[model samples]
Target: MALRLDRRRLVMGGGLGLAALALPGGAALAKTLLSASGFTHGVASGEPGPDSLLLWSRYVPAGEADETRLDAEIALDPDFRQVAARGVVRTGAYRDWTVKITLDGLEPGQTYWYRFIGPDGSRSQTGRARTLPVGRAERFRIGLFSCSNLPMGWFNAYAHAAARDDVDLWLHVGDYVYEYGIGSYAADDRIAERVVLPAHDHEMVALADYRLRFACYRADPDLQALHAAAPMVCVWDDHESTNDSWEGGAQNHQPATEGDWSTRRAAAVQAYLEWMPISEEPWKSYPIGDLATLYRTESRLIGRTRQADIGAAYREGTEAALTAFRDGVWQDASATMLGSTQEAWLARELRANARTTAWQVVGMGTIMGRTVMPGDALDLLRPDLSEGAVRSFANAARAGRIGLPMWMDRWDGYPAARSRFLKAAQAADADLVMLSGDSHNAWAFSLSEDGRPAGVEFAGQAVTSNGMEKQLGVAPSVAARSFVAANPEMAWAQPSGRGYMMIDITPERVGGEWIFMETVKARTSAVAGAHRMTVEKGRRRFTA
Candidate 1:
């Protein structure tokens, strides 16, 4: 049997939708002539807009010091026969030995290929790319994932997506890379606390350290394959900077041990932009015909206030945590998660999309809208929730009934911000759909305003990192069903599974499918469960 992609979408290479031809060598194949340190790292493209996309690659030159520009060529065909655009881009240490070139003047909804040539005649890999479709396009697809912790498991989810050639774009909603230096989150003797390439065993605090970490992650074959095949629109959640990060501080960040927050914060953002196949721009949007607008918003390290810690709720024991949460702090509008700036941006976009588009699609971190806990929707592992003594840390994630971490940590925590954004969607006369990560579980919910359903949310599961499964590993299936039975608003959720999500947006209705990994403990990427979730237009509700 042949190795297959999780989605079975991977097609063997060679000029997809275009003519196949051999690429011209600008010089001696430095891959042959420039030697080992050539473009060892490979190439990736991201942030596909209406007519352009950002192309990125890294090369370790052969010499000590010479400013050189790579003669880069991009075309609609693999053979470079139909060159859409060509240019010279400079790559150097200033940007951490990387090349960032924004290609322009191309037709919308087209597939393209790009390659880089160094001074010594070396070539980076032939990277694949595509543009968003033009006006009133009926349907488009997004491969969504989040919360990938390298030390925790293999990046099989990315690998699974890569083997399939179907998705037009990939949206990695945070935890693209973890900040924990190993052993911190995973309790293990063999996986010792990561001896970070940056001296410190705790958290990353410097540029070089941050760079090294990203480099190591980008080095993953699975992550590389996914980027190689699809254009990615990525957004950061807390883990990218620190655990449970807010405007002022973080759950894992310590000013004492890590020095100043701003410096560390900048270093994280800088490294992220430099290494990942994403732009340095904080937020952006991709216009998808007149059907909908994909609005990418910054949910962490920007305007998000300190996450609702609700220390009163979680003082150690799950029962105490439950008791405390029921007594107080589930809804505190005065305590803001998204500050004024981002809040305003989201509102305005919703209003604009509502006027003309069929749907307002908000791509972001953290679950949006409200989720009631202790209800069946939060079917965390009550039966054997303490399996391996792993408390329901991530169960509360998709819905969080145990730690109750200020449901505001998710959309539940920020009732006011959720209201403000949803109201904008309602006023825009637009059907709304929110794509979220950060919670690390699959969820489908209906968003309501003033007792009227306004939007629907489809939250993706983790790429690899452990989630509700950690707390309720004993009988995940039963727990999931129990949750659905309990939560009326929440149509469904998989508290203890890992996988990616796919969304198909059209004029009539918005549909979602959660593809659960067959098993994380195995190296092979396989789908455990493939579920269909649909939200009818104007109804603002999810159904099986």
Candidate 2:
């Protein structure tokens, strides 16, 4: 009998379906009896190309000791009546029981349903995937997301986007999973029903810990639905490994206790690559027909220099100290975000894509626009803040008064590098649209280089992590207005929200609509509000 499953049914049914087989005594025996030996997590697809796509699924066998062989099938129809491509792949404990296979020889711009079949007739949940277009294309929509801290709330943003048919792709810039352990970073604030996995109750340090963390995140029904709905292009931010990670070390990673940074970083990367539906390459580009070239770059682990310590500057407690820190440390001409090799590759790709496509979209972690905290906004800080927190905010505001941006972990910290990137875009005469995350708030920026308009950036709000409203005493509206007034490049700001962005790309324009959720505390996808901003074809700036 053929098992036909729809999206809703697959979503409601948490696990994969296993067909019943007749026993020797003529009784029907279901494979579900072996609860530990089936598709553990749902299926996912990513790394889409004109004729290829990468498919992923995790399968646990009853034996658990040996490798498990599985069959992968892709079809234009959900029922698999018209099978397009089929393959066999193996997964074992080595890769955390996760299997990823790249299926080629498919038509471009075609939607296909895929699933994995086990030896015992168990079938994974059906997932839909689409290939990138080859020639001229009219429009493309991407659901942008980041910073999904599970303990904070539900993934209503993912659910909202997954339920919609408009989004063709999912672009998660970074922080897909937070690395914090139980009782730290919003633990007390966690939703009542959401509990941390027993094995992942501590900060992730080893490969096994990272693997369990990903499994916990992937187990979310909403996240699985999002993955099943469309292919995702994802990258890891600092949280995937540790907070504020750079090339050599991280702000949160203490080598003395955490062992070698390199060892820990390797484990994190290995687990991420094995668990996520992405290719082995850390940075790559996806060409969306002749419409746009979506470039995903690595900004955190590869070439990023250590972030400047504004806390140290604040401790000095002097304008001269802040100025010295800004000029000497923050503005280091040689500091880089994407590093030298990736930067050069991106510059070359930007120029090349500009010649071929109408729009050049760069997807990377962290906000690229300049955001300086308004001095008056500091007074709006919540009265509950500790003395040290208050002092830090005060120092940040003072530094902002001296023309320094608030976040040293973002593009603002690497001014010279940002200038170089903008200059590259300017030289190519490209219609650039930069999509970013990691700030946890929404922002629109009109980028410029040497007083010339370079491009526009749409920084998406976090999926669930709290924003400025949680810390500021003032309302979100007041904070947003103050931020816009303080930063000239910032054309718009949403100081508080938990949601994602729907970015539409067309030949004439590219627009991003920030869709805010009603409440992440509940398991609902109700819409609270939305804000839209668009940049015309050649203007390289947001419209009035």
Candidates in order, TM-scores: namely 0.84, 0.93
Residue 147 miss distance in model 2 (angstroms): 0.4
Clashes of each: 16, 0
| Root-mean-square deviation of Cα positions for candidate 2 versus the true structure, in angstroms | 5.9
Determine which window of 10 residues in candidate 1 has minimal summed lDDT.
12-21
User: Candidate 1: which stretches are off by over 4 Å?
Assistant: 1-36, 185-202, 313-334, 375-408
Writing each residue's lDDT as its tens digit, candidate 1 over 93-145 gives 77777777888898898999988888888777788988988776888888999
Instruction: Please identify model 2 stretches exceeding 4 Å from their true place.
Output: 1-35, 186-188, 198-201
Worst 10 residues of 2 by lDDT: 18-27
Error of 1 at 37 (Å): 2.5
Residue-wise lDDT of candidate 2 within 1-544, one digit each (tens)?
Answer: 2211223432212333211111232122122322345787788999999998999998887764678799999999999999999999998888888899999999999999999999898899999999999899999999999999977888889888999987779999999998887557554567644443322236889997788667667867888899999999997899999999999999889888889999999999999999999998979999999999999889999899888777777877899998898879887889999999998999999989899999999998998998898978667789887787677677778989999998899999899999999999999989999999999999999998899899999999999988878788888888888888889899999888799999999999999999999988887889999999999999999995
